[model samples]
Each structure stands twice: as structure tokens, then as C-alpha cells.
Target: MDPLYLGAIVAIATILVLFSGVSVGLGLLIVSGGFLVIFDGMRSLELMPEILFGKLDNFALLSIPMFIIMGSSISSTRAGADLYEALERWLTRIPGGLVISNLGACALFAAMSGSSPATCAAIGKMGIPEMRKRGYPDGVAAGSIAAGGTLGILIPPSVTMIVYGIATETSIGRLFLAGVIPGLLLVGLFMAWSLYATWKSGDPNLLNGRSYTWRERFEVLPRVLPFLAIILGVLYAMYGGIATPSETAAVGALLCLIIAVVIYKLWHPRDLWVVLRDSTRESVMILFIIAAAGVFSYMLSSLYITQSIAEWIGTLEVNRWVLMGAVNVFLLIAGFFLPPVAVILMAAPILLPIIITAGFDPIWFAVILTINMEIGLISPPVGLNLYVISGIAPDISLKTILLGSLPYVACMVLAIVLLCLFPGLATWLPDAVMGARL
Candidate 1:
């Protein structure tokens, strides 16, 4: 069979398998391995160890676990709770303050945790309940944080960006820098939606925010500032050429542990055990997907399917914007079914070459792709953040969470359009700070 037709069939099969409730990593491995054996016999299967295991041997990949630990350890503490309190204290005077406050805390917590579900679980546990207490509607209260949680992958020190960097051989530092402006842009868009929602409802409770003393506001800072500083330190170390991402991740992870122990008194063996256990589980899951993706990519490359597809796309005479739209639609569909990390690992290799060939900046596209993933986090089927929100606030039906999150989904879609109009939103900082890629 021609590689093109076979590739299309394989793609359809992969999606079907995923929808059947198989674990993503395992599903990829099974489908890829089976197809490879059938494609070229058992001899081809022997190379799996060299192709897959060798991919796992990357040194930069070490940063993944460290970053996971940074998020996990901090999450085990009262940090998310305190971060929400800090933002809540200040934003409470405004209409829809609770909603805005949750989004603000989510952005900050995303910086610290770099995991979407973790951000949602940590913040929603506290923020959602409070928003309900303030008489905020279900959709606005649960939906806001559910959408906000998607920030984890776009913020600095994001594991998803790191995965993309490693897969494409792009600079990790540049990817991190690339995400900063766009991440903030998404935050702004989310808040604007919150404010607009507040206005639309004309609910007095949204306006009647509780006042906080300056002392209460100042005190929450001590607990939250350290995590913020850790994020800044990681960004600077990587951008300023002071430390490698792995080294930065290592230091950030250590600081998170120290703060969790000293400030939050997370020193008990049971607490530490839970942190390690959860981090390990999440990290292993991500790494397994990456390894599976490596094998899948290898299958395509070995058979020339990926190159053939890219060449076909590149040869098309269609306008570049139309091509980008097609690519974004495909990414959005993939994101709806898969977690961001899995999507990045599976798609980046094939897409990066085509993106460069089309004269698009890979880093800018990374931001656009992350925004698409943000939508997926709120969208149905595999919308992980929606489930996270539903788990935390069981009273809020899935339909309510999905409906509330729709506007934020529109906000993310608008973000992608904006980044398309002004690519600088994703590129300016990286080019200015590190100089543009040749």
C-alpha cells in the first residue's frame, strides 16, 4: 500500500482506539507496534528498543520530572490555597471579583505547578466553593477555573513546551520565552470574559465584594512570593544563560520542597510520600506517552509516511493562512481527544518541518498550538480540566461546566486569531532577549 493511504488509515485507527477508552500511551504503543510488524514483518519490530528506548535517554528530558516535582511538592502544601487568597483579597472589591480572582490565582499557580489538572484541582477546591458561597452562578464559578487551569502548559517552565522543544530540537529557553507574552494574553482574555460576564448578568453579588484589610493582603504574599520567585528564577536562568533548564528545574524543585516544608510544614513523611508518589505517577505517564510517540514517529519516518505528508502539504499552492487554518483545526481535534503532552509529542515532529517549510516561525506556532490545547482542556470527551472541575464540584453538572467554559473557549480561539494577526505576541520577547533564530 502507498504510504499516504496507509498513514491515513493508521491515523483513523489511532483515533478510534483512543475513543474506545484505552490509555493513550498504551494505545499508541499497541497500534504502532502492531502496524509496524504488519507493515514490514518481525525484523522491523526488533528496532523498537533502539528507536524508543534511545529516545528516552535524552538529558533534557530530566527537566520533566524535576518540573513535575516542583508542581507536585508545592501542590501538596497550602500554596494554591494561599495564592488564591492573595488574589482574592485584592480582586474582591470588583464585580465578578471571585471569578477574576480565581483566574488570576490560576495563572500564578500555573507558573508554579506547570500541570493543568493540578492547577484546576488545587485552585478549584478552594476557589469554586467560595465563588458559589458568594452566589456566583455554577457556570461562571466552575467554568472560570476550569478554563484558567489550562494556563499550566503555556506558562513558564511548562512541561508541554519543554517536550516540544526536545522533540523539535528547538531551544527550550526560546520556547519558554515565546510562551510568556501569549500566556499573559490568554490570562487577559480570560479576565475580560469574566468582567464581561459580570456585566451581562448584572448580579449585585458580583459587585458586592468583601473588603480586606491591607494586613491580610500583605500576609498572603510571603507564602506565594517564593513560588513566583522560583518561576522567575527558572525563566531568568534559562534566558540569561545562567543555567540549563534541567539545572533550573532541579533548583526550583528543591526550593519548592524547602518552602513546602518550612512555610507550609509539609515535612511529615506521609505528606512528602504523597507528593513523591503523585509526581512520580504523573511524570511516568507523560514520559511513557513520549516514548510511545517516539516509536510512532519512527514508524512514520522509517516508512517515509511523515516526509511524504509534509512534502505533500508543502507542495500545495493554497494560501498560507488557509494551510494554517487546516493545521489548527487538526490540532484542535487532536487536543480534544488527547492530553496536551501526548498531542505535542505525537504532532510536533511531523508539523515542525512543514511549519518551517511554510515560512512560519516554529516558536510562534507553539504558542498557537498551546492555545488550541487550552480549548481542548475545556472541551468535551477528553477535556481533562472539565473533569477536574466536575470532580471537585460534583454538584455542578458536566453540561454546566462545559457551557460556562464555552466563552473561555471562545476566548482561547480569539487568542489564536490574535496571535496569527500579530505573531509578535509569541515571538517578540524571545527574539529580543535571545536574538531571532537564523
Candidate 2:
């Protein structure tokens, strides 16, 4: 049996199973196991343990749970409300002020927690209702938080970056630094678009927000200082060589607990248990997907499928720019149906090599991939963030949320193009800061 034929069959089977409503992890495992048995017999079954363990046996991968826990702990506290309140006071005077404040809160939350859904849940719970009560459009309010929540994966402490780095053997620290600029760029673009949208819609309520006095703005500062300190501390420790990515994660988690218990005093003893339980559940789901994707990835390598595809791509003689554009388009389409992690897990093995061969920097490609995942998180059909926002604001129709996300999705696509054109946007900071270390 030809490998290409087998690969074709596996691809078709995955689509069928996934579309049939099987979960992504189970679907991948089922398809991969079937192909493995057919091609390599029962002897290959024994290698499953090794493949699973090998994938999980990474120091950087440990950070996923830690980051998730920190985010969960924060969500369990009043920090989300505090962060939104603080930002709202300062931002309301600007056009589309509430929306801008929501984006700002989402960015700050993303920096603390690397999970997209977590960011959406925290800020959307607070922002959406407040925006709605202020007479903001439901779609626009929900969309702002949905799209902004994607920053959880693009900003530092991003689980997506950690997974990508561990899977590809890229430097996790450098990947973290690389995301900083692009993340800031996306934040700016999203806010700018929100202002334009508000202005164009001629919604006076959205634009004519009250301004906070300097004293009022400073009064809310204490509410956010604790989380802000931890974020800065983690980045500084990592960049200063005081800690590895995994260690930074550990420290961040500890600091979040301290802030929750000591400073905020908002976390009850029972809340700690809940946070742990929820974080563990989310982490297990992610690891299960990683394990499944690992086996699938191994099967791709053993069958030489990825190499064959890369070779075929090389022979096309297409300009690198054209190939890059095509790859972005394909990823954008894939984002609509698949969760970001699964997309990276399954596609990175096949796509990263091709991008590297085409003279693109892997770190830069990592940023580009992260941004693409951001767009997918809000896309329709199966965008996880859209559902997250919907879950938080049950009254906000899914259609309204999706409609609002379209503009932010456009902003994400623009950010991707900008990163592609000026690779330095993603690479320059890491190059300068990490220098020889990177």
C-alpha cells in the first residue's frame, strides 16, 4: 500500500469522524490507531507508551498547567471585576471607550493567563454586562471581549507558544519575547478598529462616555497592582536569566495564590479547591489532546508523509511570498473548524518544516501561527472563544457575538500580514534581548 494512499485515507477519515461530532482528541486517536494497525501491525502498538511519554516529558510543557491554574485562580477571585473597573475609569472618555477598556482588560488578563477561553470568561463576565447596561450594542460588546480574549494565546505566558516551542524544540523564552510586539500590535489595531467602528456607527452612547477624574483613576490603581506585579516579575525573571519558563510559571502561580488570598482576600478556602479542580480538568483535556496529536504526529513521520508533502511543495517553484500567503489562507480556513492547539499540533509537524525551508524564521513563524490561532478562536462553526463569550453572557446571541468578532478577525489578519512583511516585529525584541542566548 502506498504511503500517500494511506495518508489520503487518514485525512478523509479524520474529517468524517470530526464532523460526526467525535471530540478532536478522540477523533485523532481513533484515526491514527486505525492507520497504525493497518500499516505496521500489532508490533507498532507497543510504541504507543513511548510516544505518549516522550511528548509529555518536556520541562516547558509543565508550564501549561501552572499557567492555567494562575488564570483559574484569578478567575475565581474578584480580579476580573477589579481589572475591568480600573480600565473602564480611565478609558471611557475615548471613542468606543467601553470597548477599548474591555480590550485593555482582556490584554492584561491575557498577559496573566495564557488561555483564550479563560481570558474571555473572566473579562466577558464583567465587560459584556457593563457594556450592555451602558446601552452598547450587544454584538459589538460581545465581539470586543471575544476577539480581545484571543490575546491570551498571543501575549506572553501563552500556552500556545509553550506547546509550539516544546513540540518544535524552539526556545520557549524567545518565543515568549517574540510574541510581545505582535501582541501589542494586535491590541492597538483592535482598539483602533473599535474607535473607528463606534465613530462610523454614529452611536452617541458608545462615544459619549464620562471621563474619570485623576483622583478616581488613581483610587482604582490598588485593585490591579498585585496582578500587575506578578506579570512584570515573571517576564523580568525569565529575561534576566533568573528563571526558566517552567520556573517562571511556578512563580507566577504562587504569586497569583498570594494575591488572591492575601491582597484581595477574595478567595475562600473552598475557592482554592475549585480552582485546582477546574485547572486540573482543563490541563488534562489539553494533555490528552497533546498525547493524541503526538501519536498522530509520529505516524506522519514514520510514514514520511510530512517530508513527502514538503518535497512536493519545494518542487512547485512558487515564490516564497505566494507560498506564505497560501499557507495563511489555509490556516485561516482550518481555524474555523479546529481548536487552535489541535491545529498547531497536527499542522505544525507538516507546516513548520516547509516554512523553515522557505527561508522564514521559526520564531517569527511561531508568532504568525499564534496570531492565526487567535483568528480561529473567534471564527464561527467551532471557535472556542465565541462559545466562551456566549456562555458568559447567555442572553447575547451567538450570531451577534460572531458578527462582532469579524472586525477584530480582520485586525488579526492584518497583524499577520504585517508580521510576515516585517519579520522583525516578532523577531527583533527576542534577538536584541536574548541575543546569543536565543
Candidate 3:
């Protein structure tokens, strides 16, 4: 059978099964199993267990659960509300102050936590009500949290980056450094849009914010100081060659546990138990999808589908920039349905070679791709962050949140353009700090 025709049939079948409401992990497993039986014979089933186990047995991959636990420890405690209070005190004097504070707070939290939904759940639990109390529009309040939460994947220590690096054999440390500038750029863009929208709304109600006294602002710092120290410590330890990414995660997780128990008084056995249980559940789910993706990728390799696709792309007559633009547009559309991890698993294998052939730096492209995934998290309909915020604040309609998030989406698009035009935005820091990659 022709590989192209077989690939089409497999793709269509997978889509049909996914649309039928099966869970993503189950859907992927089912589709991959079918492909194995049909394309490689039933004998291929014998290697399935080994393949799945091999996928999860990586040193860097271990960092995932540790980071999740660290994030969950903060989430399960009062750190989120305290962080919000600290930012709110400083940001409220300006128009759209609460909304700006929400964005800032999410960015800060993203530095500590690497998952989008985790960031949303932690901060949205406190940010939404405060925004409502400040007289901001419903759409803007929900939209900012949803959009800001997407930063979790773009910032350093991102789980998505870890998956991408392992999948494509890119350096995880370089990928972390690569994301820093673009992530900060998105932060600036989101804040700018928040300021503009608030001013344009012309709501006198929004102008009624009361500023915190200087002493009050200083007092709230201790609440967030420990978390901030963890973020800096992890990043520095990784960058300074003091520890590997996985080791840094372990140390960070240990410190977070200490803070939760010692400072937050979560010393009760039940409280500690809940954090471990919840973090483990979330970690297992993610690692399972990753394992399933590995088996599926092997099947794609067996059929030579990835190579065929890359070859077909290489034959195109268009310029590299034009091809990249088309790829970005396709990813944006695909983001509407697929989550970032699945998207990276399915597309990175096929796309990375074509990108390398075009003479683009893989680390730089990693940053660009990470930014696209950031936008995906906030895209309407199936964007995970949108549903997450809605769950947190049931009163806000999905449509209102989607509409409010559109402006931040534009900000993300601008960041993509800037990164594309000047690749250094993603590459320079990693090169300057880490020295040139071989």
C-alpha cells in the first residue's frame, strides 16, 4: 500500500475516534494500535510494552513530576492569594490595574510552575473575584486570566519545552534560555494591550482604584519571597552548571515542600497527602500521554511517514520564510483542537528536519514553536486554558472570555513576528550565556 494513502486513512480514522469523545490518551493508543496491526502486522504488538517503557525512561523526563509537585505544593497552599495581593498592591493605582496585576502575577507564577492549567488554577482561584470587585468588565477579567495562564508553557522550566527537547534531541537548557526573551516580550505585549483596552473602555468605575500605602506594599513582599527565590534558584542552578534540569527540579520541589510545611503550616498529614496525591495523578496522566506519543511516533517512523512528509516539504519551491509562515498558520488552526503536548508530539518529528534543512537554528525555532503553543492555549473553542478559567469562575460565559482574550492573541502574534524577523531574540541569550552550541 502507498504510504501516503495509508497515512491519510490513519489520520482520518484518528480524527473520527477523537471527535467521538474518547479521552486523548485512549484515542491515541487505539489509533496507534490499529496502525501497528495494519501496517506492520500483529507481530509488532510484541514490542509495544518495551517501547512505551523506553519512552518514559529518560533522565530529563523525570523533571516533569518534580515540577508538577512543586507547582501543586504552591497551589494547594495560600501562596497564590498572597502573590495576587502583593501584585495588586503595586498595580491598582493605574487604569485596568487589577487586570494588569493578574497578568503580572501569572507571569511570575509561570516562572515557578511549568504547566498552563496549573498556573491558571493557582492564580485564577484568587484573581477573578478581585478583578470583579475592582469594577472591570467580565470579559476582560476572565480573558486576562486565561490568556495570562498560557504563559506557563512559554516561560522557563516549561514541561512542553522538555517534551519538545527530548522529542527532537534539542538541548533542554538551551531551550529554557531560548524561551526567556520571547516570554518576557509576550509579558510586555499583554500588559500593553491591557492598559490600552482599559483606557479605551472609558469606564469611570475602573478609575476608582485605591492605591496601597508604601508600608503596606512592602509588607506583602515576604508572602511571595520564598517562591521568587525558588524560581531564581532553579534557573541559576541550571544555568551555572551547578545542576542538570532534572536535579534542579528535584531541589526546587524539596524547597517548595519545606515552605509549604514550615511557613504555610500545611504540616498536617492530610494536607501533605492531598498535595502528593493530586500531583501524582496529574503527573501520571501527562506521562502516559507522552508514553503513548512515543509509541505512535515509532509507528510513524516504521512507515517512513515522517521522512516522506519532510521530503515532500523540502521539494516545495517557496522561500523558507514563506514555508515557516505557512507552518505557523497551520499550527494556529490545529491548536483549536489539539493540546500543545500532542501537537508537539505529532508535528515536531515531521517539521524539525525541514526547519533544520532551511538553515534556521533549532533552538530559535523551539522558541518560535513555544510561542505558537502559547497562543494555542488561549485559542477559542477547545483551548484548554479557556475551559480552565470558565471552570474556576462559572459566572463568566465562554464567549465573553474568548472575546476578551482576542486582544492578547494579537499580542502573541506580534511576538511571533518579532521573533521571526530577528532570530536573535530567541538565540542571543542562550548563545551569550551558555556559549555557542556545537
Candidate 4:
């Protein structure tokens, strides 16, 4: 059989398995192993153990668990609420201030957590009700947090960026820095839309908000500032060349635990155990997927499927931007069904070379891919953030949430276009700070 046809089969089979509600890691393992046995025989199965172990053995991959622990520790405490309240106090007087504050909280929490679902669950639980209590529309109330939560994958300390970095052999720190400007850009776009929507509606209740005293604004700072400090510390350590990603993550995780215990008094053994257990579950799931994806990539390579695809792409005479548009569309479709990490593990490798050959920077493309994933978070079928908002605000219908998110989705596409025009938004910070990488 032609390797291209086999590639199609693998693609279709993987999509079918994942959409059929199979666990991501287990599903990938099944697809890869079955293909290996059928095409390469039982003898090829021997390499599976080595590939799995070898993939997990990556030094940088160690950061994944630590980062997960950091997020778990924070979410287990009152940090998310405090963060939102702090922002709400500062932004209270502006039109659509409640929604704007929710987005600000999401971006800040994303820096701390790096997991979209965690960001949505924590901030949405607090932000949604507060916004609704203040007369914010249900769609805007729910949509804002859902959109904001997608920031988790684009900000520094992001798990998705870490996964992308390791998968592509790009510098994790560079990728982290790469995301900073674009992440902020996306937040700006979201808040701008919220402000415009509310102002344009001319609803006095949504336009005018409660005022907070200076002291009230300052109240939650003590609790929230430490988490912000951790985000800055992680970025500084990694970008300043003071630590590798794993080292920064290890220290960041420790700092988060200390802050959680000190500020929130969650020092009980049971609380600590819950944090550990949660992080362990998430970390294991990610690592298992990475290992499985390693074998999957290996199978594609062994079968010449990946190489053939690359060669086929090289022969295309289309404009570079056209190719990029097509790639983004493919990524969007894939992300609508699969989570960001799985999508990155499965697709980034295959696309990186094609992107570079087309005269695009890999780091800039990482930002693009991330924005696509962000769009997916609010999109349907597997819109995890949408479901998260649904759980947080049971009264709000999913259809309304999705409808509300459409504007923000447009914002994301706009961000992608802006990045394509500037490119520097994703690359400048990293290059400025670290010097250019080969």
C-alpha cells in the first residue's frame, strides 16, 4: 500500500478513536501499536518500550509535573478568587468593567496555572456569578471567562508551549517569551471587545459599575501579588538564563505550595494530598500521551509517511501565506476535536519543517498554533472551556456561551493576522532578551 494512503488511514483512525470518547493516551497507544504490529510485525513492537521510555526520559519533560503541581496548589486555595476580586476592584468603574476584570483575571491566572480548564474552572466560578450579580448579560458573563481561559496556553509557564517546545526541539524559554506579547495582545482584543459591546448596548447597569475604595482595592493585593511574583520569577529565571525550564518549574512549584499554605492555610495533610493527587493524575496523563505520541511519530517516520508528506508539501507552488492559511485551517479542525496538547504532539512536528521552508519563523508559528488552540477552546464538540463555563453557570445555555464567544473568536483570528503582519509580536521579546537562537 502507498505510504500516503496508510498515512490517511492512520489519520482517519486516530480521529475516529479520539472522537469515539476513548481516553487520549490510551487511544494513541492502541492506534500506534496496532499499526506497528500489522505493518511492521511483532518484531517492531519491541521498539515501543524503548520509544516510550526514551520519550519520557527527556530532561525538560520533568517540568510538566512540577508545573502541574504549581497549578494544582493554587487552584486548591482561594488564589483564583482573590485574583479576580483584586482585578474587579481596580476595574470597577469602566463600562463592562466586570467582564473586563474577568478577562484580566484569566490572563493573570493563566500565567500561574498554564492549564485552560483550571483557569476556566477557578476564575469562572468566581467571575461569572459576580458579573451576573452586577447585571451583566449571561452570554457576556459566561463568554468572557470562557474566552479568557484560553489564555492558559499562550502565557508564560504554559504547558502547551512546553509540550510544543520539547516536541520541536525549540527552546522552551524562547517559546514562553514568544507567547508573552501575543498573549497580552489577545487579552487586549478581548477586553476591547467587551468594553465596546457593553458601551454600544447603552445599558446603564452594564455601563456603570460599583465603585471601590482605595483600601478595598488594596485588600486582596497581599494574596494576589505573591502569585504574580511567581509568574515574573519564572519568566525571569528562564529568560535571564538563570535556570532551565525544569529548574524554574521545580522552584516555581515549591513557591506556589509555600504561598498556598501560608496565605490560605491549606497545610493540612489532606489538602496537601489532594494537591499531590491532582497534579499526579494530570502529569501522568500528559506524559503518557507524550510517550504514545513518540511511538506514533516513530511509526510515521518508519513508514515514510511523514517524509512523504513533507516532500509533497515542498512541491507545492502556492504562496507562503496560502500554505499557512491552510495549515491554520487544518489545525483549527484538529483542535475542534482534540485537546491542544494532543494536537501539538501529533501535528507540530510534521508542520514545523514545512513552515520553515515557507520562510516563517518556528516561534511565530508556535504563537499562531496557540491562538488556533485558543479558538478551539471556545469552539464546540470538544470546547472544554465552554463545558467548563456551563458547569460553572448552569443557568446559562451552552448555545449562548458559544454565541457570545464568536466575537472573541474573531478577535483571535485578528490576532493571528496581526502576528502575520508584524511577526515581531511573537519573536521580538525572546530575541531581545536571549539573543537570537539558531
Candidate 5:
């Protein structure tokens, strides 16, 4: 069989398997193995163990599971709830205060969790109910939660960034550092959009005036400050070279455990076992996906698909910016049909090469790619965040959630444009800290 034909068939089969609701890892494994056998015979099976082992053996990959454990432990502790409550008291004087505070809380939670679904589950449960109780429109409540959930991918400890760093052989520490400014920028954009939406809608739900006294505001701060301190400590230690990314993650996980058990008193002794069990389950799922993606990527490389795609893209006479725009459009469409992780897995090998060929910084492009994925999470038909929000707020119709998310999506696009125009927004901190290390 022609290699191109084999590639086409494998791609189609992989998509069909995914759409059929098979687990992505299983789908990739099956499709890659089947293709390899058909094209290269039974001996190709020998490659599977090596591919899986090579993918999993990376020391950098250790950070992924540790971060997963950290996120789950933190979520189980209800630390996010306390942080949201504290933010609510402090922000009540502003218009659309609860919604603003929701974004703020999501950003704070994003610092710890780094997984979109986890962030949504953590903040949405608390924010949605509070927004509703405060008389905010259901659409507004749903939209805010959905939008806020995306912050997880943009912030530090982000699984997506780790995956990008590993995929491209970029510095994980630099990638994490690069995300901080853009993440904060997006959070600010979300808050501003919420304020503008409230102003335009004349929504009575927004709290106005300086209602909370200084004493009351200060009282709530103590509950949330420790989480912030932990986050800062992790980033500081990593930046200061006191820890590698994996070590930082381990320390973060340990601190999360201590916080859950001692400070919040939310996790019972029995719950520790549950957290470990859940973490193990989730980590296994992630690792399997990574390993499968590795095999699929290997198959692509063997077929010279990456080289062909890069050469084909290089032939296009368009300016680099135009090419990036095209890539963004392609990613947006792909995001609608594919899961973010799956999209990243499939696209990174192809796109990273093109990006490097185009002379763009991989770290900056990673941040940009992540923002696009965040937008994809809220996109119509297959937006995972929309479904997550709708699942929790079943009373709100999908159309309403879709419509409510439009403004936030627009803000994400704007954020992307800003990052493109000002690459320094993503690159500055990484350069200042990592210097020539990148």
C-alpha cells in the first residue's frame, strides 16, 4: 500500500473510533497497531513496547502524575470554595462583583489545578450556586463558570503546557513561566467583559457600592491567602532553581495534602486513600493517552508525514502571520470535533515542526496554542466546558450557554490577537528568568 494511502486510512479510522466514543488512548493504540500490521507486518508489533516505554520513561513526565495528584487532592479539600468565599466578600462592592469574583477565583484555582474540567468542577459548583442565589441570570452564571474553567489551561502547572514542553523538547520551567502573564491577561479580559456585559444588560444581580467594611474584608483574606502562598512558593522555588518542574510538582502535591488534612480539615483520614485511588486512576488514563500518542507520532514520523506536512506548508507563499491565522482556524475547527488532548496529540507533531520552520519561538507558540484550545473548550456542538456547565446547570438550555459564552469567546480571540501582537507578553518573564536557557 502507498504510505500516503495508509496514512489517510489510519487518520480516518482514528477519527471514526474517537467519534464512536472509544477512549482516545485505546483508539490511538488500536488504529496505530492495525495500520502498522497491515503496512509493515507482524514484526512491527515489536515497536509497541519500545514506543510506550520511551514515552513513559521521560523524567519530565513524572510531573504530570504528581500534578494530577496535587490537583485532585486540592479539589477534594474544598480549598477553592474557601477562596471563592473570600474573593466574594472582597469584590462585593463592584458591579457584577460575584461574576468578577468568579473569574478571579477561577484564576486562583487554575494556579493549583491546571486541568480545565477540574477547575470547572471546583469553581462552577460554588460559583454557579452563589450567582443564582444572588439573582444573576442563569445564562450569566453558566457562562461565567464555563469561561472561568478555561483559566486552568492558561495558568501554571497546566497539563497542556507540560505536554507541549515534552512534545517539543522545550524547557518545562520556561513554558510554565511563559504562561503566567498571558494567563493573568486572559483573566483580566474575562473580568472586563463581565463588567461590560453587566453594564449593558442592566443586570440587577451585580453588587454595587462599598458595602463591606474594612474589618469584614480583611477577615475573609486569611482563609484564601495560604493557597496563594503555596502557589507562589512553588513558582518561586522552580524559578530560583531550587527544584525541577517534577520536584516542584511533588512539593506542591505534598503541600496540598498537608493543607487538606491540617488547615482546611476537609479531608478525613479515609479520604486520603480515596484521593490516592482517584489520582492513580486519572494518572493511568493520562499516561496511556501519552503512550498511545507517542506510538501514533512514531508511525507518522516513519511515514514521513511530519516532513511532508512541513515541506508542503513551507511551499505556501503566505506571510508568517497569515500562516498562523490559518493554523488557528484549523485548530478551532478541529477543536470542535476532537477532544483538546486528542487534538494536541495529533496536531503538535505536525504543527510544531511548521512553527519551528517559520522561526517562531516554541514557548510562545505553545502559549498561543493553549489559548486556542481554551477557546475550543467553549465552542459550539462539542465544547466540553459547555457540556460540563450544562451538566451542572441543567436548567439552563444549551443554546443559552452557547449564547452566553459568545462574549467570553470573543474575549479569548482578542487575547490571542494581543499575544500575537505582543509576543513579549508571553516571552518576557521566561526570558528574564530562564535567560539563554531557552
Candidate 6:
């Protein structure tokens, strides 16, 4: 009969529904609605309409659809093929150069697209065949694409950052600014691991003893500069407060379209229609999740579960370091079973309050949490990246991709530990830029 007990049941039921193949939006709505009716009676039904409308009314949320359109459009237009070709020409001299190039291309594409699946699909299609033709091992090729793809969320213009900012009421612009350095750091780490792996494989012949001309190396730079320009333009506008997040997303989308149409001359009027339709579909799904998450988050608040959990964690005498380490472990475990978006939506509400109560910076926690999600992308069982790569290389078993990804996963874990030890890695830019404004 207790509200707390009933709330617990509803929460469990929600998890069951998700695991049993129900849509996340529908599961959250069903559970939240069930709790409202059982706990607050028929009078509670009146609140649903307003709650749903309020959740959808968020102006900042408009950025989601716009950015998705931009990413999908750029992706469909095959703009990244140019960047990959340029990178390949520059990196082709080294052993496992193509593999290393795959990582670089994915990182660049991620900065542009900000979606892991898109990054994986685009770069994988190009890189996998090249690497295979060049005698790279199947596992290595698959792992490289899968691991590199995760840079999408870690890099700027990231949908993950936007969603986290919306949930925690943090400045999305500041969060975007904060991710730039750390994302690049992870890319560097992955590059280092790829080089080391190549060296360890003992295939000096893989280098093909090839070298590029000075003129040729310099030539590719110009072709790749546009991708860099678009990313920097979006981030610069957001960081400078020259544009709001949604406005910047709109600008980025238009810029991507122009680049495809005018610069690349690859896009046509019909292509625009397809991009809009796909973006609308993806945006609607994300918005539905956001709306349902808002209702579920509201229900959690009404039940005092967040407050209770925060109070309990706050009362503990453990070191802050221990708490953070525990949070990383929790996130990794949760990622194995839940999708990254769901993991963030469900866990952030509960864990964030505890994090803030313990005097940790919310933005730093967001970065740390994002890294943990990256690990989940490569981890076995439910690693989405693994599946994405596997779909590309059906011959390579899921187990092999997971095994091959281990070193990159270690690199990510090390990156997280470094960031945890030196929170400045994550906080410095945000503070330097945002602090001056204040």
C-alpha cells in the first residue's frame, strides 16, 4: 500500500518492458502512467496532457532535429569519402597506415556528424575494404571502425552532450566547449594504440615501403579543411555566444548543405527532401524519448526517489575519488544492458543529484560518463558499435571484435582515470571561456 513500494514496482516493471522489446518511450509512459493512476487516482490523468506538452515545448530541444538533419544529410551525401581519401593519401606510407587512417577519418567524421552509427557506417564502408585489400587482419579492421565510431558522441556538436545539458540544466554551449579537448585526447590515445598494435603485429611488409611526395602531402590538406571549418564554425559561434545552441545547429545544417551542393556539387534538390524526411523521423524518435523521459523523471521526483537516493549518498563518508570510481563502474555495467541514450536518461537523474551533493562538478561528471559509454560501445553482449562493425564484416565473429577492441577500451579507461585525477582536463576550457563571460 506504500507509495514507495508501489513506485519500486513500477520501476521494475518499466525495466521489464524495455528488456521485453517494448519501445523506450512507450515503456516510460506506461510505467509513469500506471504509477500516477495507482498512486494518485483518476485525478492524476489530467496532468499528463500538460506534462507532455511542456516537455515538447523546450526550445533548446529543437536543436536535436536540426542537427540530426545536418548529420544525416552530410552522411547521405558521402562528403566524408573525400576526407577519408585525403587522410589515406597522407597516412599510406606507414605500416598499418590505412588502419590508422580509419581512426583519423572516424574522428573527423564524428566531429562533423556527431552520431556513432553514422560515423561507423560511413567510415567503415570506406576503410574496411581498403584495409582488407591491404592485408590488414579482419579483427583489426572491424575493431578499428567500431572503436573509432564512438568518437561521434565524445566529440563536439554531440547529441549526447545536448541531451545531457537538457537533462541537467547545464549550459549546452559550455558542455560542447568542454568536450573538444577531451575528445581530441581520446583520438590521440586511439591513434597511439593503433600504431603500437601495428608494430606489435610484426608485419613490416604491411608498410609497403611507400612514401608520399611533399607536394602530394600538402595537397590533401586543402581538401580536408572544409570539414574542419564547419566544425570550428559551429563550436566557435556557440562558445562565443554569437548564437544559441539551436541557432548554431541551424547554421551548421545549412553550411553542410551548402558544402554538399556548392563545394562538393554532390547534392541535388531531391537529396534535400530525403535528408529532411530522415532527420524528421530520427528527431521524432528522440523527442518522444525526451518527452517520456521528462514524464518519468517527473514521476521519480514526485515519489522522492531522487531525493532519497541523494540523501543516502550524501550521508556516506567515502572519499570523492571512491565515489567517482564507483560511478564509472556502475555506468559500464549499465551500458552492457541498456542503450547509451537510455542509460544516460535513466541513470543521470538518480546519479547526478548524488554527484552534485558530493561537491563534484556536473560537467566533469558528464564527460566521465560519456567516456564510460564509449567503453560500452565496444564491450561484449550489447555493444552497439560491435554490431555495427559486425554487420559490415559478417565473417568476423562478435567475440573477435570484442577481443580486438580490448586495447582501445583500455586506452579509454586510462583516459577516464587521467581525467578523473586531473579534472582540469575537462573543466579548463569551460571555465576559461564561460568564467570570463560571468
Candidate 1 lDDT over residue span 1-438, tens digit each: 888898898888888887888888888888888888987899988888787788899999999999999999988888999999998998888777788889999999988898888899999999999888877778888888998899989988899899998888888889998998989988999999888887777777776588999998898899889888888888888878898999989998999899899999998999999999998998899888888899988887877888888889888998999989999999999988888888898888778888988889999999898889888888988798999999999989999999999999988888899899999989999999998777
Q: Model 4 residue 330 lDDT?
A: 98
Summarize candidate 4's per-residue lDDT along 1-438 as a digit string, tens digits. 898798999999988988788888888888989998999899998999999889988899999999999999998988999999998889888767788889999999888988888889999998888878877777788888899999989988889999999889998888988999999999999999888877776678887678999999997899999989998998888877798899999999999999999999998999999999999999999999898889888988888888888888889889989999999999999889888999999997679878887888999999999999999999998899999899988889999999989999999999999999999999999999989877
lDDT of each: 0.88, 0.85, 0.85, 0.90, 0.83, 0.82
Overall local distance difference test of candidate 2: 0.85
Top TM-score model: 4
Which has the better TM-score: candidate 1, or candidate 3?
1
Report the Cα lDDT for residue 109, model 3: 85
Model 4: worst 10 consecutive residues (lDDT sum): 195-204
Per-residue accuracy of model 2 over 307-402 as CA lDDT, tens digit each:
888887888889999999988888888888888888888888889889988988989999888888788889877789888888998887888888
Q: What is every candidate's alpha-carbon RMSD to the true fold? A: 1.4, 1.9, 1.8, 1.3, 2.0, 2.1
lDDT order of candidates, top first: 4, 1, 2, 3, 5, 6
- What clash pairs does model 2 have? none
lDDT of model 3 at position 403 = 93
Candidate 3 residues lying further than 4 Å off, grouped into runs, are 204-208
Output the lDDT of residue 274, model 2: 90
For candidate 6, write residues 1-438 as lDDT tens digits.
Answer: 555465567668877988888888888888888877877787887888788779888789989887887788678766678778778878887666777788999998987887888888888888887777767776678878888999988788888888888888888887887787899898888888777776677787765535778887787676568767988888788878798989989988888777777766655778778878888888888888888888888888877777777777888899988988898898998887776777787777888988988888899889999998988888877888888888877877888888888888988999998897888998999889888333
